[model samples]
Target: MKLLLTSAGIMNKSIHDTLVDMLDKPIGESSALCIPTAMYGHPWVGPGVQAWEFIKGDARNPMVNLGWKSVGVLELTALPSINKDRWVSLVQETDVLLVAGGDPLYLCYWMQQSGLADLLPSLRSVYVGMSAGSMVMAPHIGEYFVGWNPPNDSDETLNLVDFAMFPHVDHEMLPHNTMAHAEKWAADIQGPAYAIDDETAIKVIDGAVEVISEGNWKLFSS
Candidate 1:
C-alpha cells in the first residue's frame, strides 16, 4: 500500500506533482474514504466543521476536482459505538483513505475501539494522513492537547509506522505552547521521529521512506 503522511493540504506545487505522478491514475478514476477522525479537538473543530460542510455539500465538486468519483466521509466522533463492519467495508472498498487533522489522542482511542487499528496495515488502498491523522499512525501520539472539560489521556497508537510524526511543523498556526508540549513528548520517546512542515509529506514504499516536498524536513532519532 502507498502511504502519504502529510503535514497539511497539498499546497506545494512540486508535492502535488509528485503525488499526482505517484498515483499514476486520473483523479476522477479514484475514490476516497475520508476519515476525519483526528478533528476531536477545539483547535480543529471549527475548521473541520467548515471543511466537512464543503465535502458534503457538492460531493461532485471535491470528487471531480480532485480526480475521484466518490468520497465517503465517516462520522467517527461517536466513538466506541461505531459499526465495525460498516467502517471496515468503507476502508476495504476505497481506492484511497484520507485522514484529516485533529487531536491525535482522540483519533487513536477511536481507531483502537473501532478495531481499525488492527485492520489498516493489511489494507491495499492508498493511505493519506494529515496532521493528527499522521500522528495516530505512529508508534506513539504527539502532545497536542484539546482544551475540553477534562483533557483525555494520551492513548496508545496504531503503530502502522515505526516513527512518531509531528505535523504542521514550522507553521504559524501551531501554537508556541503546543510546540513545547510536543518537544517534551519527543524527548520522552526512545526512537526515531519526524516533524513535517505544512505541504510536506513522507511517503513510505517497500519499507523505505522518502521525504517529498519543496521545503525542509526534520528528523530526530536516538
Candidate 2:
C-alpha cells in the first residue's frame, strides 16, 4: 500500500500534485472510499454533522471533494456485521482510501475490530489520512494524543510505519499543539517522530519515506 499521510487533507498544491503523482492517473478517473469511523469516536468531532461534512467533502480538510470518479463510505465500525467478501472486494477495487481525522486510538480500535488493519497489507489502494487518521498509522501515538481508549489501554496503534507523528503543530486554534509540546510528547514516544503543520505531509512508497511540505515540519530522530 502507498501512503500520503497529512496533517490536514490536501491543503496545498504540492500535496495535491503529489497525490496525483501517486495515483498514476487523473483524480477524476479514480474511485475512492471515505472512512468516517474515527469522527464518531471523538468528542470534539462526532456521530453528527462533522462526519457528514467529511463524507460530503464539506469539511475544512479537502478530501472526498478531490473529484474522484466515484466516492463511497467504508465505515470500519459497520464492517464486522457484514461478510468479509462483500467489502474486501470493494476495498481492493478502489483506487484510494480517504481516511478522516478525529481520535487516533478510536480509529485504531475499529481498524483492528473490523479487520481493516489486517487487510491493509494486501491492498494496492493509496491511503490518504488526515490528522488522527495519519497518526494511527504509527506504532504509537504517545500518551498526549490518546483520546478514546482501547480495551487493552495501550497507546499503540497499527505499526504500519516506523515513525510517529504529531499533527496540527502550532495551529492558532490549538494552543497545546506547539513544537515544544511535541518535543515533550516525543520524549515519551522514544522513537522517530515528526511534528507537522497543516500544509505538511509524509509520503511513503515502497518503504521509502519523503516529506512533502509547503509549511514547516521537524523530524525527531530516534
Candidate 3:
C-alpha cells in the first residue's frame, strides 16, 4: 500500500500534488472511504460533533472534502459485528482510505479487531492518515501520545513503517507539541522518528521514505 502520512490532512498544494501523484488521477476521479474510528476513542475529540465534522469534510483540516467520485464512512468499530464479505470488497475497490486523527492506540485496537490490520498488506489503495492516523503506522507512538490504552497496554502500533512520528509539532493550538517535546518523546521511543508540523507529510512507496514539507520537520536518527 502507498502511504501519505500527514501531521494534518492535505493542508497545502505540495501535499495535495503528492497525493494526486500517488493516486495517478485527478481528485474528482478517485473514490474514498473516510475512517472516523479514532475520533471516538479520544477523550478530547469524539462520539459527538467533531466526528460529524470530519465525516462531513467540514473539519479544520482537509480529508473527506477533497471532492472525490464518492465518499463513504468505514467505521472500524462497526466492522466486527458484520460480515467481512459485505465490506471487504468495498474497501478493495476504493481508491484511497482517509484516516482521521484521534488516539492512535485506540485506532490500532479497532483496526486489529475489525480485521483491517491483517488486510492492509493486500490493499491497492493509498492510505492517507492525519495526525494519530499517521502515527499509528509507526512501530510505536511513544508514551506522550498514548491516551486510550489498548487491551495489551502497549504504546506499539501497526509497525507498517520503520520509524515513529511526533505530529503537530509547534502548532499554535497544540502548544505542548514543540520540537523539544518531540525530542524528549524520541528519546523514550529509542528509534528513528520525525517531528512534523501541519504542513509536512511523509510519503512512503516501495519502502522508500520521503518528507514533503511546506512548513517544518526534523528527523531524529535512532
> Which of 1 and 3 is the better model by lDDT?
3
Give Cα distance to truth, residue 151, candidate 2, Å.
0.3
For model 1, residues 1-222, the per-residue Cα lDDT tens digits are 777788775556666665666667755777887776566554645444545653453232122136567877765665357666656777777787777666777777767666777777778787777777777777775444333222444445777778887666666665652455556657866677776677578888666788887775678776
TM-scores, in order shown? 0.80, 0.98, 0.98
Which digits, one per residue and each the tens of the lDDT, describe model 3 over residues 84-159?
Answer: 9999999999999999999999999999999999998789999999999999999989989889888899999999
lDDT of each: 0.66, 0.94, 0.94
Tens-place lDDT per residue, model 2, 1-222, is 999999989999999999999999999999999999899989998989899999999647999998899999999998999999999999999999999999999999999999999989888999999999999999999989887889999999999999999999999899999999998998888679999999999999987999999999999986
lDDT score at residue 51, model 2, on the 0-100 scale: 90
User: Which regions in candidate 2 have their CA more than 4 angstroms from the true location?
Assistant: none
How high a TM-score does candidate 1 get?
0.80
Residue 106 CA displacement from its true place in model 1, Å: 0.5
